[model samples]
Target chain A: MATLTELTPKLAPMEPVPFVVRSIRDELSDTFTLELDPPDGVFEFLPGQFTMLYVFGIGEVPISVSGDPAQPSTLVQTIRGVGAVTYALRQVRPGDVVGVRGPFGTEWPLAEADGHDIVFVAGGIGLAPLRPAIYSVLANRQRYGKVVLLYGARSPSDMLFTQELLEWGGRYDVDVLITVDNADRQWRGAVGVVTKLVRRAPFDPHDTVAMVCGPEVMMRFSAQELEGRGVPQHRIHLSMERNMKCGIGLCGHCQFGGRFVCWQGPVFSYDELAPLLLVKEV
Target chain B: MPETLVLDRSGLASILSELRARDYLLVGPTIQQEAIGYGPIDSLDDLPQGWTNVQSPGASHLERRDDERLFGYVVGPHSWKKYLMPNEVVIWRGERTDTGFETVPPEPAPAYALFGVRPCEVAAIAVQDAVFMPTDRVYRERREAAFIVAVNCTQAGANCFCTSMGTGPAVGEDAVFDIAFTEVDRNGTLAYLVEAGSDDGAAVLQTVVGAEPASDADLAMLESVLQEAAASVTKTMDTDGIHDLMLANLRNGYWEDVGGRCLACTNCTMVCPTCFCNTVEDTMTLDGTTAERTRKWDSCFSIDFSYIHGGPLRMTPEARYRQWLTHKLATWFDQYGTSGCVGCGRCITWCPVGIDLTAEVAALRRVDARQGLSVPLPEVMA
Candidate 1:
């Protein structure tokens, strides 16, 4: 393994190093995935961490890592062009040089749930942040128990990594269920909220560990449904989203209550966050 | 070993000159726009002497005192953060190159000698130290290089509550300082009791002429003055179980009541010494060739502070107020294992509506106690 110093020598936490866009793949109409190659070394990060992507003349925004962690040199980030910075990032072509800082924040608790049944839940473009975790689980398939993935999107065209999802579902050991809010004429999958699929998914609620990522409201309801199925609050983990300006936690835009989501978590268990989440507008 | 000495009022000039000779920019409280604020102090003439501050909720003014005392007034709107962390700092500037872009990190800060630092301010700096010292390169370098000349407060303002917070009125033994001084009125003559906390402080004092070793009587006078100052504090806070109290009453109506009156102008947060929230911005040159990323002080009161893709987490004024208070008194204990507030009372004095945190806490406790007593027991349990 290359040391951090060798990866980006003499770089400050806030400093952004140059990375060239190797390729850009359109995931959805609004979202695209970028594969980047650093000037010096690979950007090594764990599953469920994010990077602060900077466009040359525009600004910087936090985008989650959406690639396999094993290949640390290949920097991959999936972005939805919602804001100004992201919009500029979406227009980038291959060979364009952009500044990249981090691969920061808390990682998914994949290793901690070694023997336990794993349930991965995602909503809309939220699946982008969970792709790395899914890859980690698939690579180390024998280390865990039953693995289930439930994904929900707005429409058929909105589904990300469609080919990979199908391949994962084809595996005899995995269960993949995809849902859409509103289905088109050709759609054949279930059409309802993602949480509804939880009732039919085969897993022992007591023994399973669930990781959820999506909109705030969706995550809240999903957590509720998981709890209703007898899953302990601590066993249900969810990734939180906040305006992250400084990925190092100093900028303070990502504070959720007392915890800086940039540092302490973007992934937190339901038990640790229940009290703060219960309070309105925390 | 800590050594004590006596320096008459006339000796302050020599101290300033010594620090100036050492290439340290001297900063102290000075008369500025009817208030005593921290600014560049070239000599003793700039220090706010014979002028004490009168502070109440939402208001503060400088008035003439009967006797001459350099450090009589408590803290003003300005804090050490303006010097250390700064309001605006360019973290790095990037220039476009043929390959990509070359970035330049910010320059290191100059050495500073902060004169007239009170004990509470020291505690505030320490709280910020725990925060920025670990992660912030700029703050750590500037704070580590600072030469602190702490002044033990002999007078407490109307809003002062450092005693309740156990942070001030006197520089405690455990407090970190280069030099600590307590102004004593002996037979109506102003004399400063000086103590060296570090070896550098002792070396500086060695250069002073006609300085006498403090006798037991002088030490006795200093003790009585500090005790009187501590007893004179008008505001108090019950910090026991304050974290739990705030958490339990997060949804209480008191927040709504206070929020209704709060303009969310962010005065309290801006004036607070420990509120370290900030935001970053990128500014490009006219030609768009070079860009600089600057970090500025930010307040949680603003709706944009917590903004995400959908909307801001805190939309209402009440929620922002709760966030500020809860983080200061409660969640901060959970985050850093110490209260964020150093009890400097700047928030109370600088607040547009004069919102007193101590009063708010007291009110919440009263309401919480009342609610607990009013709850009826279950018939089966009874």
Candidate 2:
């Protein structure tokens, strides 16, 4: 076995990277995004992959890369201040130093998505992990046939990357749809559950890869919706997240059924997690 | 290559004293709070002398024998895993400074030797080797530096079935014990048929025992005692088709029935020699300038163990029970190439409500027989 000293992370030294937080957009009363500079290196990541951003004295949190993979490392993380680690991350300033650990976990079914239409559905801060796919399709322009982005949130204010959503709708190559559970006055968009938009998506079931990431209920509902649409269970992908510390399989905290989410996958097909899905709470 | 040596009772004492004088933190079995626990000892007197543990259906206690010997028990609650995998380990600490945050790595402890480890316990260590000390960087450092003295078991506990598990009764060829000893009664005088499995073990034996030779009869008696002990085992588990039986029962109602009574205290996993699930946490000092990263033993019984973004994946005790059992019995073959349970019986003995795994497996087998159907689960996709 290789020594621990030899396997320590050396690709990127444990030094702080400088990033100017351009803005703190409040997607919801509790959920927000700290849009910062592209790191020194090209921060490339596939959809469903995440990065471990270290806040000084506050420890690291695994937040998904919420920007386009084609662009040079402009990191955007949507987070909820649920625990101490995240609460500390939420307090960072416009100019702060944060260390990074990943691009970890199996990214969205990229090879499996070839020659297939893509449908992306996200809920609340769950959009953070799937936004990369939305960007990938927009950047590629002609690689995919049809692309659909369906996102749902608690309210209109909870919608993330709204400006990008509007721009995506204007694109000739992609279709963008947003839904919210409740809306106050001045809100103009779909006002229902995201599953309702599944019927309106433009794509063939056999040639589509439906990606869903959100609250477990929303993801489950979206999976059922896609299954109803005749998307083979193996072709539909879902990005899963858990409370993790090591972001490596060593921690053993994020195992789904018998598979380690950090090692075997963070992105898995419905056919794979289906057995566990039926067993309740999974 | 193996080196042979003989250490009489007096010579064995000299070696123990030598190890103690060197401050190697000699850990062995001793009666602690009425239960035989493995802990640091200063001299040979602290060993489990004539008293050996008698483990039964639901209880374990020490029993006195007429003769005096260092290792007379099959196994106690203390396995080598406790020290190697540790209940709590500090990975590193980060402190906030004006310049930035600086992280300090945890210090590794001095080298130590575990003496009088039973053959089954040695087998348990080898199982842990597949985990922590695997072809990974995680536990390589700790395992490579540790030392073990394997002691042959001459008697099987009432709950012991390691012979059926293909693990023990005596140390096998591939076991990584530095030195192994098989106790033998030579001409009514007690002596150990010692063999050094490593150069370090041979050097220590040469310095202490100072014996040039031992007869083949002494070694044969050692083998005979181990064979008798293996033959005397009263408990057994047919692990051959056990994995298939468990995999078939994924949706079996027995899981829910038993899980309803489970408290989710994870006592079974905590006492299990092979359950190595853990969780990591980060904490900051009151001043908020310093933080420490620590990994602590965790169990599958907790709701947070399989938590996704919004909530736990396995919330019900029934679902959690199914996960734990299937992982230990069925999927473990896929992960580690063997059943996770070593038949140490610690889980059966230490469970608060006395959830016996042997009984559970037997019940499942009965269910399989009554149904007259085999379980058919799809091949697990990688």
Candidate 3:
């Protein structure tokens, strides 16, 4: 038998600090993005990581950081008014305080994909979560090869980060392909599922790392399409979504098979998640 | 034989007095509404003496024993979790300040003396520790201050399978406990063979009167009694490759069969000492000023357990059952270094429809023999 060792007492698990909302911009009728100022002029987080946004007496919801990693003074998150908590977040005014507990979960693997071409597949509001990764790649553009972003939405109006997409489109280094399921009268871009653009998208599949974020069905098919084009399954990454009640793994709501989506991943390689994704209604 | 103390029935009363004088809240089993339930007790007379619980799948009742042996019952609906983790607790409380909402420091956990904790329950507490410790200070504070007194089972219940789970009959060598006792019931006369696993436990016993050091004969008698208890457990869960067996057969139709009978009532999880799944909810006053973030025990059996923005991932009742079962038997080993189930059989005896997981596993193995099981692709892909 060995002598027992003493461990330091664990701090309180759930601690929410107040962050003042600097601005709120409506991306669509039901969606909005919030810019918050932390007490200290810094709140650092990896790309693809999320925070538990608490709206005072309302509730909390897991929202990913859509801001640039370089900017620590301002914490940014995009959310849809799908539930009570999110709706309360949308109603918050600038200067109003909201609670935040995070910078949790696995981040996008930009370092692993440094020298390889990066292909981003984003659908509707899913683009918000992938925006930070896009910013990171663009900032270190010289380290990476060809960069392509294929974004899809229900309609042209449902698209998020439209202004940012236009700027990325103008860039000579990045190829931004936009698609809508249903075209409006003024729309002129590709009108189909994002997976359709996977065919015409110019990137070397053998030397490319694909980052996908979207509804489950879209991600499954996008990864399938990427795999068909010779991109290794392990190189294709996805940001998973489950009921993440607690950003910590203590709440069992975010379990996707053996993995806790809040902890082990919101980002997992296609190869690692292939078997789990295959299991129906799990 | 290790140094042990022999405490007759009178000594048991003295032990209770000593614990009370130490200001420790004694939580032990007592007769409650025709069933033995864990509650606060002061004296030996408060124990469910001369009473035994007859537990089967979805059934349990109190029956008077011929001998007045304390700790006669196997287990009941109430587990020690009610005291430690609790059913509902306000982990965080906040009030609206002029700046914003600020959290109020929570009150400290109560000091508890868990009296007559079964060996299987001792294992269950250890399982929960692996699940909650190092991260959840809310549950840790309660667990760290609590003292456990484990009692060995002299007889196994009808639903008992702790022997098969390797967590029972006699407490496992690695099981956590402060003190352990094996009751020797000889024709209605009761004597406890007590041994301290901690210095604090020994110090407490040192103060009790009429405590005599045990002899070699008493130690041998204790060993045979434990052996008898193990042999009596007819119900067994064969754990050979259970992890892979469960994870591989996610679409087993046996789940559909169990789903038909299981009411999704959440009784099993409530009784399961190791089922630590919970959900946090926020409650505010009518004025919408002060708010509390409360953590409540939740069951995977519920339809809303896996709900996201769109809907619940597991809409089908059979899918929920599969999630609960697979998570318990297979993924638990992956999450914690040990199996989630201590095999106390509380889940079996307390289940509304008697959905025995041991039998469910047997059914899955039986059905799997046919091969070519249908594991349909995701609804969208299909």
Candidate 4:
């Protein structure tokens, strides 16, 4: 996270410099990924940080960076064209220009969890924010212990990073377990909530750093199951998403209890957020 | 380290002229739509002469005072945030052309001399300073350029609790007020004991006609006036362990009761001095050639404030009201390292339903002993 108050942005706070879309790839029916040529040079950002993407005259929304942290040349963002702003952003052609602000918020503990077993739990489209951390772990695969990824989607077709999931499953060093809420006869993997696979996943709970992201209810259940496995609350981090504007923390839209999810979080340990997550509508 | 200057019967007029001479757009208290609103002030006559306000839960009335004091009334519905953060402003404007786009940069903040600012409002400005400091662009510019002239309160409104909040009826020596004044009644005529907090204010005072250095007795009278003002505030919000109190009772039953009465009309947030939540609006021409991203005041009470992929997180009035109250009383400290409220009574007075937060906090404390997700219970309102 941006803990230092003095490291302000280089550009004018609200002003946006435009960037051209280099490529577009459709991940799912409603979700797509946009890779943009950097406005200045390279759009450097930490794993799990987000940017406020603006569609010229349409609007802006906070989208997490889904690209590799090491690749600073191209900025990659996943959009679930759910709102007017995201829908407008998806309408952009390859050469079209758009606005970008920030690379704000805290990063995943990929560096801190280097010596520990890493378990990544993702639900539905939650993999977008966790992708950067996965890439980081793969780049420095020798530095980590056991690596496991437990992903659950609404259906097989709704899953994200399908190609990468298969590639990781083929590796002997990485454990990739996939599940779905409902499936047809064509499917062979487990068909249940992701929380059920927490017990069967191969990792020492005491020596693992768990990073989870998904729907709130799924995250809550996954966290509970993880805690039940004897993994400490502080060792488990959840990537949170909340409504926010002016990602610098001026606008109060992203306030989750006392924590501004835009700045202080986006990645908060279960120990810091257990009390808040338990309450409904908090 | 500046001494108080005494301005005679014509001193008020000279002060107004001096401010106008500096090319500052003077914004002060005035009568607008049956309320005291901060608007343009051309002369001393523009002030609400003898008007006093009576504010209570869900109700407020204007009454004529017997004395002919210039600033007899306390703060009304208007706050200084309207000028600094603004209700709406085009922060970024862009025009699309054939090859690329042209841009019209945001305009600079205007030079302003804010007259008749109260002590509570001053504290509120400080709270906002910590919030917008990180992105210090428009807010910092407007706040830095605008001169502040704080006036010590002669009386407190019924809903006011500045004393309890420790953001006073008196502007202290440590305050950032450019010039502070205490209105006094000398025999039958009205006079002012002026103290300059900044060098610019002292320089302006030196050029004023008929201005003389105030004596020790005059300074003592100013103390007495502030002491009386401090004793007059009736309301209170017991901030003792407020942070944990609200956090522990997130699902407190009393919140449901407050939700039942809250209209969610958002009058309270609009009138609040330190409520700095806002939303950005994008407007473009029919041809889509030009676009402007304007920031407007927003309330957490609004459903869209929490809208995400599935739907709005805070769906019910109870949830929205809980978020707003908990944010104002508790979570604000964690976010900005300071209390969000300044204890100004605008939220209480301007609320159409009169859902007082002071009463709500007290009620929350009473019901917290048996905390649960229980149905709405009888209110413990005082």
Top TM-score hit: 3
What digit string (tens of lDDT, one per residue) describes model 2 on residues B1-382? 3656777887877767766665667887888887788888877788878887877655788889788877777676667767777787766566665645666654665456888877777777776666555333335556666677888878888777787777788887877777788777778877887887666667677778456566677666776888897898878887768777876566666666667678788887887778888876667788877777666889889888876555676778877877788788877777778777777788767666767777777777876733764343222211
DockQ of every candidate structure: 0.43, 0.34, 0.57, 0.47
lDDT of prediction 2 = 0.73
TM-score-wise, the better of 2 and 4 is 4
Q: What is the C-alpha lDDT of each candidate?
A: 0.85, 0.73, 0.87, 0.86
State the lDDT of candidate 3 residue by residue for A83-179, as single tens digits: 9999899899998999999889999999999999999999999999999999999999999999999999999889898899999999999999999
Where does model 3 sit among the CAPRI classes? medium
Question: In terms of TM-score, how similar is model 1 to the real structure?
Answer: 0.95
Candidate 1: where is the Cα deviation over 4 Å? A1-12, B369-382
lDDT score, candidate 3, position A92:
91
Error of 3 at B51 (Å): 0.7
Output the lDDT of residue A120, model 3.
Answer: 96
Clashing pairs in 2: A38-A73, A281-B313
Most accurate candidate by lDDT: 3
How do the residues B1-382 of candidate 1 rate in per-residue lDDT, one tens digit apiece? 4778899876757788889998999999998888888999999889988999999999998889987788778999999888878889887789998878888656778789999999998888877776777677777778778888999999899998999999989887767778889988877888888988777777888877778888988888888999999989989999988988888776666677678788999999898989999988888899878999888999999989988888888888888998899999988887777899989999999999988999988877877734672223223212
Could you tell me which residue pairs clash in candidate 3?
A: none
Candidate 4 local lDDT, A35-138, one digit each (tens):
99886779999998999998888888899999998999999998898988988887888988888888889999987798999999999889999999999999
- What DockQ does candidate 1 score? 0.43
Model 4 over residues B137-213: C-alpha lDDT tens digits?
87777877888888889889999999988888987655676888889976567898888887777777777898778
Residue A59 accuracy (lDDT) in model 2: 68
Ranking by DockQ: 3, 4, 1, 2
Residue B312's lDDT within candidate 1 is 82
Q: Scored by Cα lDDT, where does model 1 land?
A: 0.85
Under the 3 Å rule for N, CA and C atoms, how many clashes does model 1 have?
Answer: 0
